[model samples]
Target chain A: MDTVHYLLEGFGTALLPINILFAFIGVLIGTAVGVLPGIGPMSGVALLIPVTASMTGGMDPAAAATSSIILLAGVYYGAMYGGSTTSILLNTPGESSSVVTTLDGYQLARQGRAGSALAIAAIGSFCAGIVSLIGLALLAKPLSEVALKFGPAEYFSLMLLGLAAVSGLAGNSMTKAGIMTIFGLLLSTIGLDNVSGVARFTYNIPALYGGLEFLTVAVGLFALGEVFKTILHKESHDGNLAKVGKILPSKQELKESSGPIARGSLLGFFVGVLPGAGATLASFFSYIMEKKISKTPEKFGKGTIAGVAAPESANNAASGGAMIPLLTLGIPGSGTTAILMGALIMYNIQPGPLLFQDHPGVAWGLIASMFIGNVMLLILNMPLVKVFAKIIETPPKYLIPIIIAISVFGVYAVQVNTFDLILLIICGLAGYYLASNDFPLAPLVLGLVLGPMIENNMRRALTASNGDFMVFLEKPISLAFIVIAVLWIVIPFVLKLKGKKVLINEEA
Target chain B: MSKTFDRYASFIFFIVGMAFMIESGRISHSAYGSNVGPNVFPFLLGLILGLLSIKLFIETMKYQNERKEKEALDYKKFLIILVAAILYALLLEPLGYIISTFLFLLVGFQTIEKGGWVKTVLISASFSFGVYYLFAEVLKGTLPGLPAWFSS
Candidate 1:
């Protein structure tokens, strides 16, 4: 009952003309970002933060944060919907999460059922979005309530668990991921020390005083890094696009996909709620599950509608599910969510248990906006998918340079200094070389975002215990979190030792 | 993965870790009321990073030597664009937003693919002026306008 009242107020906030316009613009741009191959959701969101910041400059701080977040979250999920279009039409996954959709999506397109495949994907995404939103609304209150009881010790341990979980499943090499995570943490400690107001490792450089701007590093790493890769590799997509015939799926196709959509949504929601497993894993699992249970499993790779439906739904649902931990626990489970968290922090709004109590307008407003955003996505995607498909034809020549321009413009707008611009370029180079060598950039970004909070909590807990480190282990909840963190890292290493191939979440 | 790159990266990371460990010591040891100081966290993280880099170094040694096909990279193009981007950043404030942005985009488009001069000029012009007008004029944001010499 209480949730209902909050949600009603949230609806009132989301329905405001400005907020509605922001949501509309967010999903619209999100679909375009998804349609474009090179820009993933992380880069897309990072690139837009400065733009949104500037656009919302006139609003009151709280309203500004709400509108910016509403738009950004829309982009995050809208990308999931747009990703399937490219996979089906061009045989190219727009983002990593949509990789599995290419398996049957292209085959269905080849059979001239491209329209049905697209319709099913849109419908599945819509259903999954609603399912995950329901789950978020239901779980948000209780989860935050549980988190409210956590002391500094528990928070320190919980953050550690988040770090370990991300590093455990990040990339091909856990060691490399660990190195990146530690490097990010070290980088975070470079600026003024928050605890004692002592400047550490600044070397008297005024730019280093604030530490590395999360926006600068993120834009450099994801956006400019991808651009550099494209330039160096001479990557150009010239695939022939599949033609769209009918705009709707048949009754048989719809009926067959309903079960997969439902099951995928539930499965993906659970996977998403976990710390490390994300949309990529959820989609992969759903695809395999569908194959395993199908009576005619052999038909899966040969253009089964279920193949297109399940993974699409699962990935969308997983993105929705990823929000649970961020909103409630203040821990971002994926790279994109990490960026989102940074955006919220930039607005002086910390997302956590206190987020609901302190700024229900931002939290619930964001939640309510997502419901409207999903509807906008379904409506926009159904008729305008062909228009989005045209986006694939955008020449890499123009796109690449414009992306570079946007990166510079964004960083300059926010930082207004040459130092950050130089740092941005350097980070872009390092990001290219490091990522090319299989060092996952996601954990690095995650570590940078989470590092200060982890240190603060650690110090606070130690302070409470008179400098005894055992305070972390003395508390039952803290001890459990520590044990879980250890196992999260160790279990993956053990699985590799046993010669079993462990699935990694590449998108995260 | 390039074994050479990994080996060099591991070594570089080790040096970075060492630098952090050495530098963190200069920070004051203890805060006024707390036993833990600002220096403690970075020092510990530096130690862990050093250990992880060593592990990465050892892991690189265990990799079996397998010659992989190396794709030809467009280093020339990348270098050109990179230099252009750096110049864009350096000259942005001095040359003002429109001119610097316009010149950068033109160079970028041309470098990526030759020809399409009219299209390139139009796009570059529109983008620079459009963003300047929208952000600075309408949104009331700060961006260096046309150069002082030109305006005067």
Candidate 2:
């Protein structure tokens, strides 16, 4: 009863004319980001943060945070819907999460079923979105209530677990990812100390006192890094796209896909709830699961509607699921969510147990908007699938420069300082070189965002226990978290040692 | 993975970690009633980072026989854009948002593709002026206006 009441109130906030417009723009851009080759949702959300900040500059702070977050979150899920378009039409996935969709989706397109495949993907994503939202609505209050009981020790270990889970699965080598994570953590220590009111590594520089702005690092690493890669590599997305003949799926096509969609949504949602396992992994797992479950598993790669339906549903659901940890536990499950968390912190709104109590409007409104955004996607995607297909041919020449301009503009608009712009460029160079060399950038961003909180919690725990090193081990929840964290890293390393091919989340 | 890059990166990280550990020790240790202070976290992180750097270094040695693939990278284009971007940043405040952005985009578009000057200039101009007017005038957001001398 209480959940229903809160959800209704959320709809009230979501349905406001301005919020609706924000949602529309968010999804529209989100789809474009998804369709475009180089930009993933992480950079998409990062790029939009400053733009949203400037756009909502006129509003009251709380309302402003809510509105901007609404748009950013829209980009996050709307990307899922758009990624399937390229996989089905172009035989090249727009983002890594849609990689599995390409296996059967491309086959279907070759068979002149591109339109149905696209339509099914949209429908599956819609269903998965609803399922994930309902799951989020039902679980939000209870999870936050439980999280409120955590002490500093538990919080410290939990955050450590978050870091470990991400580092383990981010890139090819656990060692490289681990190094990036530590590097990020080290970078986070470059500012004034909060507990002692002392400067640790500022070197008396005015800008260093506030530490490196996460926005600069993010936009530089993701947006600018991507731009530099495109420029240097001469990679272009222009290609022949398969024609989307029909906008509607036939009755049998829908019937065959229904089971996969339902199953994939549930599977993806749960995978999404885990820290570090993102939509790419969720989609991968569901496609494999569907293969195992199907009676005619041989028909999988040759254009089965179930193949397109399942992975598309799973990725969308997983994105929805990823929001759970961020909103309820204050832990971002993926890179995009980490950027989202940083954006929230920028608004002076801490996301955690108290989020529901302190900013119920933001938490609930985001959930309701997701619902409306999904419906809008379903309506907009079916007919516009052909139009979106045309986006594949977008010239890298113009897009590249404009993205750079936006990154510079966005960072400058918010920071209003030259130092940050310089830093942004430096970070861009670092992002390109590091990423090309097998170093994962997500863990580094994660480390930066969670750095202060991790330090604060670790100190609080240490102080509470009279500086005992065993405090983390002494607490049961803390111990469990640390143990799991260790296992997360060790298991992956051991598996690789045994010559087992481990699946890494490249989309991060 | 490039073993050479990893080796250099690890070595640098090793130094960075050592630096952090050494520097954190200089900060006043006890500011509150509890013994734990600002330095402990960084000190611990730095030590672990130093150890990880060593681990990464050794790991790089395992793949010493790795082969290098040669692909033609457009260093000229990249360098030009990089320099242009830095110049754009340097001149942003002095020349204002409109002029610097227009120049950067023009150079960027030209560098990426040589011809269609009319189309390129139009796009570059529209984006620069379009964004400025939309942000500063329409949204009432702040941006550097035309240079004082130029406007006056």
Candidate 3:
């Protein structure tokens, strides 16, 4: 009942004309980002952070944070819907989460069922979006309430669990992921110390005082890094697009998809709640589940509507589910959400148990705006599907340079300094080289974002326990979290040793 | 994964870790009302990283010497764009936003694929001017403008 009242108030915040406009623009741009294989949601959100910051420069701080977050979160989920478009039409997934969709979606397109596959994807995404929102609303208060009781020891342990979970599942090798994570944490320590006010790595450099800017590093690694990759290893996306013979799914197709959509929404939401497992993992699992439960499992890869519907629904739901930790526990479950968390931190709006208490407007408004954004995507995608399909034809010659230009403009406009710009380019080069060598970028980002917080809690806990390291084990909840963190890493290792296939997220 | 690259990365990371560990030794040991200080976390993390890098280096030895595939890299095009971008960054303040952005875009678009002069110039000008107009004029955001001599 309290949730209902809060949601209604949330609708009040979300319905403001300005908020609605932000949501519309966010989804619109999100679909385009998803359509462009060069960028994923992580870079998409990172690139827009500065642009949105400047755009909302006029508003009060609270409203500015609310509106921009609504837009960014809209981008996160909207990408899920757009990812399916490429899979069905071009036999290319716009993002990694849609990789499974290509197996059946391209098959469907070959049979002139491209329209059906697309419509089903949109419909499934819409349903999953709604389902996840409801789940978010119901579980948010309880989860945060539970989190509020956690002391510094518990928090330090919990954050460790989060890091371990992500690193364990991030890349092919745990060693590389651990190395990247440690490097990020080390990087985070460069700035002025939050508590002691002593500089660690400045060496008297003025720009180093603020430490390496998260915005600069993220934009360089994900956005410019992608641009450099395209310039060098050029992808030839000149394949013929499947023709759209119909605009809507047939009645039989809808009936075939309804069950898969429901199951996927439920499964994806739970998977999404777990740390480190993101939309890509959710979609893969949902697809496998659908095949297992199907009456004729053999039809899965042969233009079946269930294959198209299940994964699309699952990915969208997982994105929504990913928000649960960010909003409640203040821990980002994946790379995209980590960027989103960074955006929130920029606004001085710490997302955690107190987020609901301190700023109901930002939290609830964001939740309600997602509902509206999902509806906007459905209406916009259905009618303008072909128009968006044309965006795929946007020439690389113009697109590549323009993206580079925007990234430069964005970082410059915010930092207003040449140092960050130079750093951005360097990070971009390193990003390209490292990513190509099977190193996972996500855990490094996750580590960077969580580093200061984890350190703060660890120091606080240690101080309280008089520098006793056993305090982590003394607290029951902290002990449990540490045990789980250990199991999360060890179980994966044991499985790998047994030659069992351990599912890894390629680009979370 | 390239075995050589992995080996070098691990070696480099090990050095970085050791540097952090040794450098942290210079900081104060404790802060007010607490025994733990800022240096503790970084030192611990640096030590962990040193061990992890060794583990990573050891893991690389298990790799088969896979034949290297000579990828057809567009090094000429990439270097051009990279240098252009670095120049744009260095020149952004001195030359101002519009001039630097316009020149960068012009170079970038042409270098990406030559022979779309009219479209490229028009786009570069409009984008540079349009963005400057929107961010500075409309949004009232700060940006370096044309020099007084140039404006006159």
Candidate order (DockQ):
1, 3, 2
Error of 3 at A9 (Å): 0.8
TM-score of each predicted structure versus truth: 0.99, 0.99, 0.99
In candidate 1, the second chain superimposes onto the true chain B with a TM-score of 0.98
**Candidates in order, interface RMSD in Å:** 0.6, 0.9, 0.8
Clashing pairs in 1: none
> Residue B104 in model 2: shift from native, Å?
0.3
DockQ of each: 0.91, 0.84, 0.89
lDDT per residue (tens digit) for residues A1-508 in model 2: 9889999999999999989999999999999999998899999999999999998999998889989999999999999889999988888898999999999999999999999999999999999999999999999999999999999999999999999999999999888888889889989988888888898799988999988899999999999998999999998655568888987899999999999999999999999999989899999999999999899999999999999999999999999999999999999988999999999999999998899999999999999999999999999998998889888887888899999999999999999999999999999999999999999999999999999999999999999888997999999999999999999999988998899999889977
True contacts kept of each: 0.88, 0.81, 0.89
A236-277: candidate 1 lDDT, tens digit per residue? 788889997687999999999999999999998899999889
lDDT per residue (tens digit) for residues A178-210 in model 3: 898889889999989999999888999999999
What residue pairs clash in candidate 3, if any at all?
none
TM-scores for chain A over all candidates: 0.99, 0.99, 0.99
> Candidate 3 deviates by what RMSD?
0.8
Query: What is the C-alpha lDDT profile of model 2 across B1-152, one tens digit per residue?
Result: 88888999999999999999999999889867879989999999999999999999998888867677867999999999999999999999999999999999999999999999999999999999999999999998878989999988
Docking level for model 2: high
Better structure of 1 and 3 per lDDT = 1
